[model samples]
Target: MNPKWWKESIVYQIYPISFMDSNGDGKGDLRGIISKLDYLQELGVDVIWVCPIYKSPNHDNGYDISDYCDIMKEFGTMDDFDRLLQNMHARGMKLMMDLVLNHTSHEHPWFVESRASKDNPKRDFYIWRKGKNGGPPNNWESYFSGSVWELDPQTDEYYLHLYSKYQPDLNWDNPAVIDKLHEMVHWWLKKGVDGFRFDAIAHIVKKEGYPDAHNPSGATTVRAYDMFSNLENVHTLLQNLYDKVLFHYDIMTVGETSGLGPEQALDYVGDGRRELNMTFQFEHMNLDAASPGSGRWDVVPWKLTDLKQIISNWQTVLHGRGWNANYLCNHDQPRSVSRFGNDLYYRIPSAKMLATFIHMLEGTPYIYQGEEIGMTNIALESIDDYRDVETLNYYEEKRQQGVPEEEIMSAIHRKSRDNARTPMQWEDAHEGGFTTGTPWLRVNSNYAEINAANAVKDPDSIYHYYKKLIELRKKHKVIVYGEYGLLLPDHPEIYAYIRTLEDQRLLVILNFFDKEPVFELPADMKQGGMQLLLSNYQAPKNDDLTQLKLRPYEARIYLQQLEGK
Candidate 1:
């Protein structure tokens, strides 16, 4: 196994716009993060993944970059960012910046020059094509749920944007564009940045001829957009980036890969292949996603076996040849505690149980901000409270189709990205101690009951529980290099797995629901020598490793040594 610092490190994701607001601008900024270094150090994270603070129009909340080199004024100056980076390094923490290369905002200087005239030197910097039969260039639609092509009145041609109309897709065919991206990367590496998280990189390469996808229903769906990702040159582009920039520095690069399965993963993240260190797989996240030919509006019921299969498949396949990025929630998804656990009654236990299940796997685990404090999803009283472009667009379109506003809000509560973007609950004061000014987004109303100030004071709070788990990963090489084997794969409520390294073994069992279920310990682990390493409950009922009845959201980790050891 690769024994690099990155492999051993635990990453904490910070949605910069919502983390903390210093100077009372009602927004999170670089200085706000600087003030919380001690808190992160106490949490035992080795790395911090800060979302984009680059100059942007915020059409997609910083995903739409206007200037890659300058810091967003709302987020503080470039000097403030430099101070944040230096302070983190001084505290023995690494910082990874988010890299959004798929597209650029319409306000970007490059796109401005490109759209100025048909023969402008930068015209080919973006994808522009003539209309086909007086309609769009093809039947392809943007991921935001409309035609992919946006008509340009000045040039009489349409430009492609996979996300929003204001964010135009870059034409990778232009060598100048490629050269410029490489130069920018080298510039950042020279500044002593740790690494980058490549955003939506799978869509950088498009299929040739831009053929129409063969969908009979003509409904807007993920499959329509999936057809544009993981194209023929995807690997070539990554390998070139590796040769040009990544090989020279000891940096970690993880791609936000979509539309990639086990077969394609080996090519993108294979060891010694000069590509990426790891990539976030979407298959597990898609478990709650709709079934075939359906959109995100149609939420589905998933089985325990279904989730286990996807997790086990990736763990086994990527064990030898590559690595995986372990996570349950992030900036673009709902809170893991609310989505996967029972947040109403057993929020704390279920949060810790979920943590034990994911952190013990053979990968680097990531904790989103506020996750350690057991944050739950908030119900926005009205659509006006949400700042996400996706949610607003979804509400507008679904309303036009005769969907009730209440039904749309129900789905939004279940799936909107805003659920994860609420201001951090630092203390029980107004605005959850996030800012002195009115927050850019609404703070969750339950912050008074679930704020960090209370958690830090309580010895048994979820925050402390997470700190113990992070410390275990740092001390036990077994957790980082162990072989993974899923146990009781068909079990309905108990999620169980075993991690093995020669003479050492760790068995992790988590009750996924809020009900007692009898779990018969596997016969192989029934031997009397095993030690109870940890449990979520103060005292576990399963004293002996025989037939055991688990309480609601119970988590147990038992350790066993081989005969010779």
Candidate 2:
């Protein structure tokens, strides 16, 4: 496979609101990020993806943008952002900005005009429909639940909002809207950004009729996802945008796709087809569910095979035809340590194991803020401690639905947005060194024990493990472009894979369980002369290769230099 710069790079995602606070304003800003460029450089990451810093109402934690051209005052001025971009480039790193084009805050000028009289030209810029029988336009449901259409007092019509009522979905069917979005893309590209991380990119198109779905969850309202995502015309719109504005610019465009299958992913990211470089799929992230229905977020024990299958499936499917955005945790989810692996028992080893697991595979790896230090989910004592809009909404919704407080707390404990949105634990200080004053969100209680300051100093820390992983990917092209083959498909706890290009071959072997496992080399794996290059655990010299003993969560990287016969 031909190599692209992003193909061989690792992206580090910074939830700017929680990363670092230089001014002690209890909020992380651009100056704070500027001061930490050296820290990111040490991590060996190639790209820094900053979540939305655009002007916002903060209704959905800055996802609802009021303006595409302006940076949020809390985040600092556009000049500060420019300095961050320049500093990142000076350190040989690229920058990717979060693009939230699906919806805009109601306070935005466009939305203001859109909500005016129905005959106004700007009204068509947003989805609007007449009320059905003097009620809501349709039974469409918002992602936050309830009616997707919000009544506009001015026009006496309802506007479509796939998310919060405060965020109205844009009318992408309008050519003027398309032109404006393209202008916004070019505007950022002109500022020297490497590319964009599209927010809910699949929802850009909706079924014209706004049809309702007969979902099994007893949901009488139509799923907005069905109405707005993976529509027939969505790919054509993306292809036009890619071909005209993105593909020729050498930019890295990754789409956030909610309900996409392998075939859909291929259509979006097929080799040089000009739609997207990669996409974020939620299949793996949803594996820990206990029940099959909505509001059933009890933690279910996960098998090592479950994770293996998820990763291996994407790897096999995207080996050559397309690409994937490999990740364990992002801003939208809880930390991987608490959710995916046993943090209390095998924190460090499992953290290192996950680092090896994701970074060693093909595609671009995105490391969420502070994940390298093995940050676990915060244990909130009271519901009052939670500040996330989603969590609060769910809590209130459950209460109104007659669910007991205990059950609501249980759900919150398992799947709170606060789990991933807490302030960055920079050091073992009173405020986790996140800020001098109290953070906008509470710092996790374990910050003193597990944080960036201590991890950077420790040679054997999970932070360094990730650093080394990034360095390996930068140094070896095969790790990026090599074909992926799962060597032991049915192996219960032993995960192994091979990456080969011409004569150079690399083998990755990982033991997922805590107890030691004796793993026999597969028939295809040559036993006699494989040289071990790297291991997350200590390896004994002259050890038998045929029957290898792997310590709990131990991972080894082997390289074979085959000379031409």
Candidate 3:
């Protein structure tokens, strides 16, 4: 297999709205990101993926882009964006923008024209269907919890919106739409941006016939995924996209596939498939889902086995076919330390443990902004403070359904997207050193002790741990390009794997539980002098390899010095 740069690159994700606020305008802007380039460089990141900074109505934050060509005024002007790109490039970093082709804000010129009159040339740009029984076009429920179909009185037709009503899903079946998308891709690539993180990309194609879904067990709203997930045309459309645009660019592309796995995902990102460089699968991230197939916004207890299996499956399956984008937290999810580690009690140690668990795997590692600071989830006591559209909608619906405010609050505490959208903690200040005045969103209450300034200076901070983890990945190409083979697959409590390249073998052993566990060496790893390369608990010593033992959350990486290499 040919060596892929992304396969060994450590990508950092920046939530532009929360990364930093350069102007005292209380919102993070492009200049803020520019000023922080050195900081990011010091963190050892090669590629940076910024969330949408495109013009929008803030309905779904910046995801509901109104103009793909213009920058959001709140973020900065096009000049600021240009300066940011130059600065990032000068520092040897590549920039990847969020490409949201799934939907667009209704205020967009194309959408406005489409909605102006049914006979407009742009009307076919969006999906507009007539009502079947004097109601919505279909029973599909939006991802944000209402009817996915929105009535457009102007055209007397219902438009599809997998997300918010203000955002209409584009009709990908149209060739015109594909042409425009290709133009947009080239526009950014020509402007010097490296690539894109395709947003909700799996929702590109809908199930034909638009069948009614099987009603959710406990919820009143129907899940549209049941009707549209992994639809037949999805692969066909993706192949067309690859042949038309993505294949022509020398840039990285990762799809935000909400419902795909190694099997179904191979066609999209399989080796040399010309579809995408990689795809972000949410299988591991959704381990703590309150219900198996339900979209309940509550976090249930998750075991280490759940995480281990999710990672093992992707790593094993993607060893040769496709590639996995390894991550713990993103803009839509809570902090890793809070979700996977014991943040309150074992903050530093657990953060390091979690970092070692993911970074030392066989894929590209994406470090979310503030993740290096050992950031934890926000504990919002009142629902009024939540700013996400989905959270607000859920709160209102839960209220009307007589589900007590307390129950709703509990769910929000566990699953609200706002929990991860808080401002980045720069230092211990009035606004957690994120902004001068009131921030666009509230800062986490614990930011006083968990800020970038503090973490970067502390020797034992999670930031340093992340630095070491990334340095290891960049230094050892095998960690990224090697084949992954899980060891002790049935060892109830331990998560262990070996990544091997030609003549070079590395072993990662992790004790996920609090109790100490012994990991017997596999037959292949028994005969060699092993040197400890890295460890989350303690750096391994040359003599400590006679059958490995790991303490609670202890993760270690060993270099097997083969005798015949």
**Best candidate per TM-score, number?**
1
Better of 2 and 3 by lDDT: 2
The alpha-carbon lDDT assigned to residue 374 of candidate 2 equals 93
Candidates in order: C-alpha RMSD to true structure = 1.2, 1.9, 2.0
In model 1, residue pairs whose N, Cα or C atoms come closer than 3 Å (at least 3 residues apart or on different chains), thus clashing, are none
lDDT of 2 by residue, 1-565 (tens): 8778888888999999999998888999999999999999988888999999999988888899999999998899999999999999999999999998889999889989877787777898999988887778777777777788898888788998888999899999899999999999988898899999999888988887876666666655755566677787888999988877886688898999977766679889998677998999887776776744243255676666776787788888888899889998988888887776668988998888878888888889999998889988887878899987778878887899899998888878778878988999889997899899878989988888999999999998999888888888877877888788887777788888888777777788888778777767666556336877677775554356678888878888877765661
lDDT of 2: 0.84
How many residue pairs clash (N, CA or C atoms closer than 3 angstroms) in each of the candidate models, in the order given? 0, 0, 0
Q: Residue 48 CA error for candidate 2 (Å)?
A: 0.3
The most accurate candidate by lDDT is 1
For each candidate in the order shown, give its overall lDDT on alpha carbons: 0.89, 0.84, 0.83
lDDT tens readout by residue for model 1, 65-127: 999999999999989988999999999999999998889999999999999999999999999
- What's the ranking of the predictions by lDDT, best on top? 1, 2, 3
Worst 10 residues of 3 by lDDT: 537-546
